[model samples]
Every structure is written in C-alpha cells, then in structure tokens.
Target: MTPADLTCTVLGAVRRAVEEGALGGAVAVPDRVKVERPRPGGSGDYATNAALRLAREARLPAREVAEVLSAELTRHPGIAGVEITGPGFLNITLAHGSRDALVRDTLTNILTSGSGYGQGRALSGQAVELRHRAEVRAAVTADAVRRLLEAQGALVRIDAYEDEAAGPVPAPTPAPGPAPTATLAYEPSPVPAGATAHELHRRFGTDATRWALLRAAAHDRPRLDDGLLVQKESNPFFLVRYAHARSRALVRAATRLGFTAGYEEDAAALGDHPALLAALGDHPAVLASAARLRAPDRVARHLETTAEAFLGFQHTVLPVGDEKPSAAHRSRLALAEAAGTVLAGGLSLLGISAPEYL
Candidate 1:
C-alpha cells in the first residue's frame, strides 16, 4: 500500500485510543503525524516517531508508549509488523504486495484524470483564454483543442480558419504591427477533409507510446541525421505534451493559491490574464510561442504559447525582503510550480516529455 493508505490506519487507531481514554491523558497530542520511507538497512519499510512525540502528553515512558502504539498497528490489515526502537520510534512493515494495489490504483487514477493526473488546483475552469498570435498556429491549436474537447465530451464552438487546409495565407510581415495583417489574405474555410486524427495517429503517432517514442528515439531507436526526426511526426506530439503539462500545473497551483482550477474537483477560479512578454521572466518558451504560431504546423506553433506561459511562470519572486519568500511569494511559487506541473502533464497526455528541469 502507499504511505497514505498505511499511515491513515495507524493515525486513526491513535486518535481512537486517545478518545477512548486507553492512554491516560488530560489532553491529546495536538500534532501532525508523519510517515516516511525507512532509512537504508532499517528494519521496517516506514517509520514514525509519533509515539515519542506523544509520550510527554500521555504522561508515560516513550518506550511504553511505543509498545502500546505497536500493538495497535499490527491489528490492522495490510500491516505485517510494527516494532518499537530508537527511544520509542515506531516502524511498520507492510504486507507482501500491498503496494501493487496502490500502484494499480495510482495508474488508474492517473489515466482517469487525463492531463490532470497529479495536477494541483491553481486554476480550474477559470475561463482560461489563450490568445493565438500566428494564424497557422492558432488554426492548428484550435483544431487540436476542438478534437480533444470533443473527445472528452466537452461542448466546444469552433471558428472557421481563413487559411483552410494549409492553403497559402498571408506571408509573414517584415515588421510587427497591429495584430497581424497579411499582404494578401485568404481563408477558404475548407470542409473537414483528408486523414482523420486517428489515421494521423496511426501513421505518425507510432503507438500508444507516441510521446515516449520521443524519448525512445534518443536511445533504443536507430539514429538519424542530426538526431532530427521528421518535423511532421515529432511536432504534434510535442504540442500535445506541452499543453497538458501547463494545464495540469495551473490547476494545482490554483489549488495551493486558495483558488480552484481543475477539471476534477471544485476548488477556485482562474483569471483570464494575458501572460505579458515583458513579465515572462525566464520563460523563453512563452516568447517562442508568441513568435512561432504562424508556421505550417499549427499544432507545434500553438504549443509554444502554452509552453512559454509555463516557462515564464517557473519561479515568481517578489520585491519583499527581510522575510523568507512572502505569503504572496509562497502562493506565487505554488502557482509557478503548478505551471510547470501542468505543462509537463499536458505534454504527457499528448505523448510528449515534460522535462523535470527545463
């Protein structure tokens, strides 16, 4: 079993003992209980010093308290043994293969959660508005999102793209100006045609491990020129991975920030604020997304926006000094952390890598 599954059992017993007056006390220990991985060569799988911490409040010797606690733990299912050592510390060893169920459950939860498998709630369904700068990027991203949403049974309204079916649109402007103006604009609003998303996935996605294929390409697969895979093949996977990661991160950060921004649970709402280029901080991806949206591969181009937002938000430092990261800083830090988590998570669902550091 996972730590939570085991810890909850012991914690509940301890609470019950205190309530039933099994351990004489004018007061119960008002402290948090913790379970941690046992040290190397340790006799048990998980260890806790709760008994020692409660000894004073219980008006009993530490070892005596640990003995009583140990008895209480071994009575539970999924518990193989509980022992007292090191001045009344409690160590618990779980039953054989208990963690297998936990692992299975965890994987099931992850799959059910979609891109939000381990995501925090920084911003849930807060009407997040992603502004697309490149027509091609916007179109590709728009189409991708529509497909994803439709698959998820989410109602979505799609706008017709002017440059239908990757047809010739306006060339890139020599200089940046108001929004974007093509020298010669054309958006045919082409009817849905060509291979379906499923067919594309079969040809280019490679397999269910499509995103993992990105990693596999680096080692197990045969090497290619300059380590470059076909842009058409690699680019879509990248976009899917990137979006899922950012979205998951935002959800979690919103939760930590006392706001809810997840699709799973009700928590808080997010603001539709533009992640400004000036305040992007170290988030170069955000800048890239803004700049690269017009390329032929709209999915890849659209991905830059989500990724840049994630990178821009990695660490949100404030002007506050003399205090350890202010409350605002802590919340922002959570937001930033969630940003990365969501970015990575989104990418994973889309079969992409959410690199731990960058």
Candidate 2:
C-alpha cells in the first residue's frame, strides 16, 4: 500500500477507537494522520505517532494508547503486524504479498496516468509565486519548483528577479484561512569551480548539465566535470539512464520469448527483491515529499536509488539462457517497467530526457 493508504488506515483506526470509547468519549480524532517511512534503526516499513498524539486527550499513557490502536489496526488485512517503539510510535509491517500488490498497483497507475501518476492535491487551492535570478542555475531551479508546485495542485507564477521590481516587503501577511497562498524566493546554488552553464553544457550536453545542476541540494555547490559525461556505472546520470534503457531492453527480450509484462500477487516473486520493490512502492511518496519541500534534488536522488535497485534486480527479470519465460518473469518484467516509468517521470520533472537507449 502507498503511504496515503496507510495514513487513511491509521486515521480509520483512530476513529474506531474513539467511537468505541476505548480512547474515551471526549477524545478527539484528528481529521488526518501521518504515516511515514521508519527512521534509521527503526523497525518495520512505516511508522506513525498517532497514539502519542492522542495520549494526552485519551488520558492514558502513550504506550497504552499505542496498545489500543495496535489491537484495532491489527484487524486490517493490509497490515501484517504493529510494534510499539520508543514511547509510543507504531511501527507497522504490511502483509507478505504487499510488495507484489504495490508493484501491481504502481504499474497499473503509471500505465493509466503516465506522467500524472504522482500528481497530488497536497497543495490544492493554493497559489505560489516563485522569484529567481536570471542565472541559468537559478532559472532552472525556479522552473523545476514551478513544476513541482503545479503537480501538487498549486497555481504557480514564476518571475525572474529584477532590481527595479525589488521593493520594501509588505508588513502584514494574509490572514490565516483556507487556501493560503505563498511567495517564495529561491537562491541558486554556486556553480562548480566557477564554471559557467554555457561551458558545462558545451562540455557535458544539456541532460548532463541539468542533472549536474539539480542533483545537489540548493545549499550545496554543483560540479561540472568530465565525470558527468562518463557512460559508466560510476556516473550517476549514466546509471539512471542505463537502468531505464535496461528496463526497456528487458521488455523487448521478454516479448521475443513470447511473454509480456503482467502482474500476479505472488509474494515469492518479490521475496528476494525487497529493495527494488520498496523503491518502486516509494515513488509516489518521494514525489509528494519533493513537491512539498520544493526539493527537486530529492527526486533526483530518488531516481538514483531506484536505478540502483532496478539495476541490481534486472538480471533476474527474464530467463537467463535456454529457460522458458514464466509467470514469474512476467511479473518481474512489470515491476521493472514500473521502475522505468518512475525514472522517466522523475527525469521529466527535472527537465531532463530519459532516452530509450542510453
């Protein structure tokens, strides 16, 4: 299940607990709840602190509230188990076949929605204005932020910075209410070793130049070097494009073997490939988070991670030699295709191309 699904499930459990008086009649159920990937050293696929939030209202210990919610959430079919960690956080594990289900769902959504698969309403009904300098890096960063905000259902206006347009900032902000609007100013990161964008593009080409500018956080300087032009695994850009190309190549090979990409809810199919499955499943969340944070670098980093996972798992997607393709191969192919879709979509958001052949 996606993080959104898990969030709803957790909220539902809270509502049920409150309705049953288990959390006390006066206890309030929030309109929403958060469920996120577990932090480092934490167990389970996701974790929530809903119990801790409700503990105060429930008039119970945090751990006690966690226990109550744990019992309630355990009944959910998508959830395998819940563990109470450190005070009251609920660390949740999904059912055994959840990875397969996620793969199927991700593939189907991408096939249906294509470039819009990860579009969300997180910033719905909001208006955002972004201002940046005329430098190529600044312009590119502003453009990417515009895309991200628009994807999250915001009406975005982008403007290049102008000295004449600069004026004393307004004192009073808009009153707090529904559909709040925001204005953001972005400062571009420094160029690597004082190299100009024209120089970088001349040396590395457009895609590599964009990737070099975007792969690093805004606070971090970007590098423009021969390394970015390398066509080996050592080059992250190469790895991402190579992985997408490899995924497409796998589809052709499977087609020649008379099998097409398909999905089956077989837990064993994904048993040995948790990393790839997790990366695929996390795509929507990554996009949403990146949009919310105005961080295209996050998406860039996610592509690299997804590419590495897919590359490691690509060798097993089709028959090795004389072996015949089977249902397992089809399912694996579908998963790989989903990864490619994610990579391509992310690259598109970063204003980069994902060539069919690297």
What is the Å distance of residue 301 in model 2 from its true position?
0.8
For candidate 1, write residues 207-280 as lDDT tens digits.
22233222221214312132233333234444434444444555454455455322221111112212421122
Q: Which numbered prediction scores highest in lDDT against the true structure?
A: 2
Q: Which ten residues in a row have the lowest lDDT in candidate 1?
A: 264-273
Candidate with the greatest TM-score versus the true structure? 2
Q: What is the C-alpha RMSD of each candidate to the true structure, in Å?
A: 22.8, 5.3
Span of 10 residues, lowest total lDDT, candidate 2? 164-173
Q: Tens-digit lDDT track for model 2 on 1-358?
A: 7777889999999999988999998898898888877877678888998998999988999999999999999999989999998999999998866645665676788767776778777777677777766466766776777777777777667666543222222222222236654654444443433455566667888788788888888878876778998889989999999999998899888888899888765767767887787776777788889888888999999999999999999988988878888888888888888888888888988888999986
Q: All models: lDDT? A: 0.44, 0.79
Model 2, residue pairs in steric clash: none
